[model samples]
Target: MDEGPQFSLEDDGAGGNRLVLSGRYLVSTLGRTNQQLRAIDAPVSAVDLAGVTAIDTVGAWVASTLAQRHGAEITGAKERSLRLLEAVKIRESSGSVAPDRLPVWQRVPDHVGAMMRDLLRGMAGVVGFLGQIILAIGSVIRHPSRFRGRALVRQMELVGVSALPIVGLMSFLIGIVIAQQGAVQLAQFGAETLTVNLVGRITLRELGVLMTAIMVAGRSGSAFAAQIGTMKLTEEVDAMRTIGISPVEALVLPRILASVLMMPLLGAYAAVVAIIGGAVIGEVALGIPFLNFLERIKDVVPIHDLWVGMIKAPVFGLIIGLAGCYQGMQVEGDSEQVGKRTTQAVVSAIFMVIVIDAFFAVFFTEIGWS
Candidate 1:
């Protein structure tokens, strides 16, 4: 039979007190060992483990914890046991073990400061990315031979042609809703005819391009980020670089070009579809004829309203493309990071699109185009 662990305390003339441990220091012996330790009345200055016959991780933890609590020096440990003790000590000192908790008030400032620092760093990175994109575009303009026509066309098909059905359907429903609501309000004032003006101006000057941009940001922008981010994670982007190919030129410019070229056409299509939907609602519900709706739209909506909306489309597309590509480039070697960047790309693109639209609205208003 094996003997359990034991501890004894001795008075050392100059050393305050000494604790001696013997026998198998294992989990089965821990309770007795703890009881023996608790009975000690003297302040422990050192522990001698020379008599310890065998030990394991649980035993080491027990020994280390008692040593820490008593602020006692440990000695006479076997080489392997000493290494384990040292590792536990290192872990405790390094705060890898249980750490002290700070008050919530103290932690709040730390969290806020970290958040602010991250935000500043992110903004700086975006600015740097924008500069890089501009440099890439300038290089492409200087050397048109480097342009990838096939890639651009493929991206256009993905971003534009495939998007038409959803965009048309959403715009049509929105137009019908707007016309119905406007008719209700204008009827109260006996000015139901004004519903056509409301639908035409809102759809042509704002809603059409805004809705199209938002949808594209959610759909194409997230795809761009995920695709490029996966390529980054797989080292395909690095491979392109190694082969003397600019990732910006090969991957980014084609997408950006496709977006800018196709957005205006999509916006115009959305506007026409919405107007037709509104006309249907007006004819059926408000007793307004289709010809009368067309005449009213022509009279109320200026060509400049159409121009304003069209002009915003390319800028919105550019913002969406840049945001997606920038976030993708920022992705590290993590699948989780790819998903995070993809979501961030969509959010950032939509936000920037709205901001740009607001600026355009202000500019047009100041210039008397509104």
Candidate 2:
């Protein structure tokens, strides 16, 4: 049943437009009206939305769009509608955007108050992260048996063994791509022999870790989100709490520990496979001999490059693990929410990896050679 006040319009015409509209919006009502509006082919001026008993975002959108197309004056658009209209008005006034289309600070809320709020939020997050880490460490200490040989073996397999195939494949492809691209540029200078150094250095410090992290984040992040979300939906988290088992300690800690421990090893493996792939390409395509490639690699790849890659590896792993866990925890009992959170986990993990990689690049540049 259509449940609200049915809207009708009254015209008060005296050389001016006066439109009165009243309606109670339901799905069927709005749908039919929206379709009617689309089919309309006449001047619709001075809309009176004041008669709307209860308006929602969709109704507002429809009304606004109608106003735009017909040059009609509309009233009673609310909240989001008001902001959207204001933005549209701004755009309309500036037909061609000026050089300073928006002020520098306008892009993001740059008022002092907003800046202070953002700064406070950032600091709070940092504090919370540190506190969590400390608490985790204390819990580990209380149960030092968790660091047993068997536990280590399990984690090694979980992190290192599982990550191999994907990392190997992606790294090999990346090596080939970098080599091929660099060869095109280097060939002009007749520097075909430099492919080894180019591939080695780039793979070791940048592509190897970055590519591996992205793959793991996509693979593992989704896994964590799905696993945790399903658990949450099934009330497994509540069960764990009832059993006095800290879910964080039981699940998250192991995964984090495993990743942190194995990322360096996986990264090293990626770099090696990538180099082999690049070496194969350089030898066959670039006519550089195997021994010459090895010699070039030895000359250019310092221990520092390997160290940088190894250092970033743990950070990358932590980024993937934390993002997944965070998004998973955000999931409600709703089944759709699980999928949504899983996607967020993968996205946030990848974005964080890229941002961290950029920071590492800057750091490496600043530090220079060992």
Candidate 3:
């Protein structure tokens, strides 16, 4: 039968004692070894491991802890035992280490720097994505047979035909509100009749296309982002790429083309709806006859105004489609990212739509379209 692990102390004659260990040092003998170590009252000068015939990690931990607590040197350890003791010592030291704390003032600058880097990286991604879409467009132009007509028709129905009811209702309400407000203000100058001019010019030149674009951004734009992002999360996008299909051409181009083709029609329909709403409001509030209001619109609202809005509609559609699809392509990791990118797509598309409208307003004014 093997003897259990044991420990003893030796008086070194220099006012310090040496700890001596023997027997198999393992979990089975840990209690006995611990009791023996705790009974020693003298300050330990060193731990003598020469008599330790067998050992393991648990035993090494016990020896290392005692050596550290007493500030005693480890002595007489064989090469293998020495390595194990060193490992235990390192582990103990690492466990005792504390993380450095930063002051609030220092942390602010670090956070800001990280934000700036992230913003720059995001901008670069957008630019690269734009280039990819342009290349895909070029490829489609070169290979017209590769175009997906069914997908394009489906997207047109989604982006245009299905959205008509809400777009029409929204535009109608907006026009009524605009006419009411214009009537109230123009009545002060006995120019309540000019409300017809106000409604016609604004609806045909700006509000019709602008409002429709915003609606599409919120509806179709978010849908595109969520749909593509979900596909990405499920690795469907990756599968398309692996099978040698260009996701940009097959997935993105149809959406963009559909939006571009359908936007002018939607905007035209919205404009007519808004004019009808304005006419109703004018007849009820200002006692203006509907035929007289129609005559005023025909006489005052120019063809240029309608053309200006029509041109901006397709451009706004392109922006909405690109923004939605681009943000979708950026989705990574998980479902949370899909939701976040979808929100970003809607916000970015609306923002770009307004900014582009502002630029158009400025350009048209410079060229005397105003």
Candidate 4:
């Protein structure tokens, strides 16, 4: 039969009191022993558990608490009792309960501070990466033999030639939509003819380059990140370094060069294709001759509009390449990081491209390019 948990106070030879716990010290047997122990006002020098017949976590917690309250040494516990007491002590020390939530005012400022810190760190990383690229460029310039023309051509084909069909198709559809919408809005004013100007100026000055940049960022930027990140994961980059080859020159420069060189040609091609699509819409939907619509584009869309697109194209390309290559180079540890960095590359490139385009718009307007 189990006995109810009980305790007694005894005097030690040192004149301090000892706590002698006895019987089965379990939750069901504890009864009012918890209250009895809490009521004791005398200081305890030692918690003597030698008489404890059996103990559980709850019982251990009670004994642990008693010893802690009086700074008494726990004594004579069997291995199982000792283990239970230790586990309870560890749980208490590590906090078994959830922490209190911070107020909104404190949380908001704390979140903002953390965000700003992360932003600064990211900016520093980008700057350092840019510096490395600049140094690589200098090294390549000094040794022209180090330039990888074949890699540049391959990247050009992958980034530009392979993307042409989709880019053209998208631009064509966008052109038809723009012309149709512009014609509808202008019809109220009996100026449907101005649809030509709308499609021409918008596509050449903004939509052509902007949409192409976004597409390239999603396509080539993600590809760059994934490729380089995979290589990093496999230690191919490290192997290159071991062989005295600069990964930046052998990998990054070629991609960047190809993107920079191809973007203008692609943007111009997309704009022209879009113009053709608008012409088709004119001939089929608006009753204007296709050839007449094409002729009118040249008269209405100024050369400056084309110049704006061409100027933005290579800059957007550079941004995409840098974002992709930098993110890829930063990837470490696992394949999951490759996916994450690839996504970051695409998002960052697209965001930066849009921001730069906005700045370009303002600068061009101020300089009479608009």
Off by over 4 Å in 2: 1-130, 146-155
Q: Choose the strongest candidate by lDDT.
A: 4
lDDT at position 299, candidate 3: 94
Model 3, runs deviating above 4 Å: 1-111
Q: Give the lDDT of residue 318 in candidate 4.
A: 98
- The Cα error of candidate 4 at residue 208, in Å, is 0.5
Q: Clashing pairs in model 4?
A: none
By lDDT, highest first, what's the ranking? 4, 3, 1, 2
Candidate 4 lDDT over residue span 51-97, tens digit each: 99999999999999999889899999999998998899933356558
TM-score of 2: 0.65
Clashes found in each candidate (C-alpha, N, C closer than 3 A) = 0, 3, 0, 0
lDDT of each: 0.89, 0.76, 0.90, 0.94
Question: Please, what are the lDDT tens digits per residue for candidate 3 over residues 1-370?
Answer: 6678878889878999999988888887778668778667679999989888888888888889888888898898988788888777744454546787799899999999999999999899989988998998888889998888999999999999999999999999988999999999999999998999999999998999999999999999999999989999999999999998899988899888888898899899889899989999988888999888888899999889999999999999999999899999889998999999999999999999999999999999999999
RMSD of 2: 9.8
Candidate 4 residue runs with Cα over 4 Å from true position? 1-78, 81-97
Q: In order, what is each prediction's RMSD in angstroms?
A: 6.7, 9.8, 7.3, 8.4
TM-scores of the models, in the order given = 0.76, 0.65, 0.72, 0.77
Q: After superposition, how far is residue 322 of candidate 2 from its true place, in Å?
A: 0.8
**For model 1, how does the per-residue alpha-carbon lDDT over 162-189 read when each residue is reduced to its tens digit?**
9999999999998999999999999999
Candidate 1: which stretches are off by over 4 Å?
1-55, 58-109
Candidate 3 lDDT (Cα, whole model)?
A: 0.90
- Residue pairs in candidate 1 whose N, alpha carbon or C atoms collide under 3 angstroms: none
